[model samples]
Target: MSRTVAMVIMGAFTLYFLIPIWWLLVAGSKDTGSILTTNPLWFADFQLFQNIGDLFAYRDGVYLEWLRNSVLYAGVGGAVATLLAGMCGYALAKYRFRGREMIFNVVLGGVLVPATALALPLFLIFSEVQLTNTFWAVFLPSIVSPFGVYLTRIFAASSVSDELLEAARLDGAGEVRTFFTVSIRLMAPALITVFLFQFVTIWNNFFLPLIMLRDESLFPVTYGLYAWNTQLNQLPELRSLVLIGALVSIVPLIVAFLSLQRFWRSGLAAGAVK
Candidate 1:
């Protein structure tokens, strides 16, 4: 009876989460007129393709530019962040160095600090250096992931054995070669987790870009959609475009999660064993 109740509750939560996506699909498929007139949860016309085309073609393909910018920021930033976090975490886990606990504690503190809280300060610092409105402003900050560091540290400490490192060193492998060749393979699941988390965080980040970038070409898809959304009164036609853009924006995230789901599962199982 308890198990059945839990299943029913889980199903309810799933539907609750999926209902908005269903509405976005249905609403994005309709023209502006149909969207306001028809049922929001059901398709009125098959205008999804047309809406997508319009979204891409609008403003001389500015939406595509935004998407490209998002890809650059998220993809590169996530990869670099994962690499840096992995190295830092691995060192903290495996090496015996003075002030290691202090550094780890600081990283833990960083994990506790909210990103939004840091945004204004980061903006001020960037402005001081005259780096605001540049790609580096957003990209630099995105690459610093405290949670990623924390997670990687925990995973590395648990999964990577000290004996393995000693064996690699005994085989005449230097620290750099040992890390790249041996440790990285052992920490693949944690690294992937860090990459995905950072990727999604950078992809969906809005406030940082909102403060850092003035160039429309530099805006990520999230801010671009917001820019369109804010102009709904002036250009009511943009309403449909915003809906379609939002719908399209989430596609990459879904694809990334789907592709990397196996890694996540394996990471979980490894954690359970460790």
Candidate 2:
């Protein structure tokens, strides 16, 4: 009876999460006519391809431009953030410098501060620098991830060995050489984690883009989809396009996670072995 009850609960939770995705799949397959006439949860005519075609053709493929901007922002920002985090983390873990603890504490505090809380100040700062309504306005802010720094520090301390650094020093490896060759390899899993986290965060970020950018062409998919959603009142055809666009936007994220999941698993195994 207990086992049966547990299965029932698991099934219920699974359906809770999957139902919306299922609806999108079904809805994307329906044409405008079938969408009104047929059951929303069930498949109508397979217009998924047609919807995709229309999505690209909408407003001269503005959605595609939004997707490109999102990819550039997330990809570049995440990479830069991860690199900065890895360097800072390695320095904190391996070196004993003046005010090291203070710097770490500051990063910790930054991690605790919500991004939304900083949005206004960031916007003002960017505006002051004449960066508002620009890609750098959003990308610059996304790259300075305090949480990524913290995670990298923890992972570096655990994953890397001080003895290895000492040996590298004895072998005439410069600080930079030691970092790239020895420390970075050990910190791969952590770097990957930081990259994935920052990537998804930047990709999904809406409030910052919304506040910083007024140009629709510069908007990321998050804000672009939101714009479409709001226009649904005037343009009912946008409903299906928005749905398909949302579904399309999720694909790259899924691919990124799947591609990086191996590192996470390997990291876990290495930790367990240690």
Candidate 3:
């Protein structure tokens, strides 16, 4: 395509994606009556602050609890998942081990299997183990990301050199020390990518938490908002809470993406090299 045509196409796609966010931003700032009556793209009464205050103070500030739960699940879980994937991927890349190809193939297969497909089986097993409706039910499952492992393996193979590992070893660095100092350093960008991916996945996760957690205190933001949405008729006041809550929920994801964008660029470049 011509440059002009490509630019136009890109602009169109960008607008398509951004329009909803724009609408959400506009909608969240308006009162419930104006929201139902006004044009979605336009604003009326400025009630964003009021909505936010109400959002935070609603139902004994359960929204804040839900936010905290999401952050814990996403932030801590993502970091651990990223580290584990890095180690596993690095091992697969560097070591000549038995069943290496088979293991990798199995992991690749796992990438194809959607998480929703496994949720039922996981719930059944967790139920049998008597661990359902607890924090562990959602958190334990969120830490495993097959795609993260796949990406890390590709990054390790391309970015981390055998020469560097050998040099570290010759300098009397132990396996773990060398890995942390040399390999993980080189793999920082890729690891960040894995972390952000896992973080977003866990943050936006709904069904897993929905099925696993019966307690409102344990509900993540997504599930909590969904519950509020279901009660829109009974608790019409919750409409404002839901809208404002959604806007707030997305803030972290946006901040995270923007903050880590530089790492992503470097990581993509590294991944592209080999």
Candidate 4:
């Protein structure tokens, strides 16, 4: 009875979350007329392709620009963040230095600081340096992920053994060379884990972009969708476009997670064993 109840509860939660995603699909396939008249959960005519066509054509293909910007910000930012975090984490784990624990504690403290709280200050700082409304405003901040650092630290401590470092040293491998060749290869799973986490975070980021960017051309998909949503009151046509845009924005993230899912699972399993 207990197991049955637990399974049923889990299924209910899954359905609860999935229903909104299902509605986005159904809504995107619908014209405004069908959206107002037909059942919300049921499929309308298969106009998904038409909706996409209209979406790209609208506002001189602004949606595509938003998608491109998001890809740039998330992809490059995630990669850089992953590398920095991995290097810093490896250093913290492998080396005994003064203030190492303090640095670790500071990273932990950063995890507790909400990103939203920093938005206004970051904007002001960027504005002072004339970086606001530019790609750097969004991209620079996204690369600093405290949680990624935290994950890399934990993973490095357990997965990377000191004996291996000693062996590498004995073989006359310089520290930088050893880190790149041996340590990084050993830390592949952790690095992938950090990359995916930072990728998703950067991809889904809204508030930072919303604050820093004023130009429509620089908007990421999340902020772009929000702009469309706000303008829907004046431009009723944007309602359907927003729905379709929401669906479109979700695809890359889903693809990313699906492609790297095995790495995530294996990384967690490796952590558990270590």
Clashing pairs in 4: none
Per-residue lDDT of candidate 1, residues 175-254 (tens digit): 99999999999899988988998999999999999999999889999999999899999999999999989999999999
Residue lDDT tens for model 3, 1-274: 6999999999999999999888888889988878888988988888888889989998789999999999999999999899899998998899898999999999999999988999999999999999999989998998888888888899999888899889999999999998898999988999998898899999999889878999999999999999999999897877877889999999999999999999978886776675
Which runs in model 3 stand beyond 4 Å of their true positions? Answer: none
Residues 1-274, model 4: lDDT tens digits? 9999999999999999899999999999998768778899999687999999999999799999999999999999999999999999889888999999999999999999999999999989998999999999999998898877777778889878899999999999999999999889888998898889899999999999888889999999999999989987798888889999999999998999899999988876776675
* Cα error of candidate 3 at position 103, Å: 0.6
TM-score of each: 0.97, 0.92, 0.97, 0.96
Worst 10 residues of 3 by lDDT: 265-274
Worst 10 residues of 2 by lDDT: 265-274
Q: What lDDT is reached at residue 197 by model 3?
A: 84
Considering lDDT, which of the candidate structures 2 and 4 is the better prediction for this target?
A: 4
| Predicted structure 4, TM vs. truth | 0.96
Pull out the clashing pairs in model 1: none
Point out the higher-scoring one by lDDT: 1 or 2.
Answer: 1
| Cand. 4 Cα-lDDT | 0.91
Q: Name model 2 segments beyond 4 Å from true.
A: 1-11, 266-274
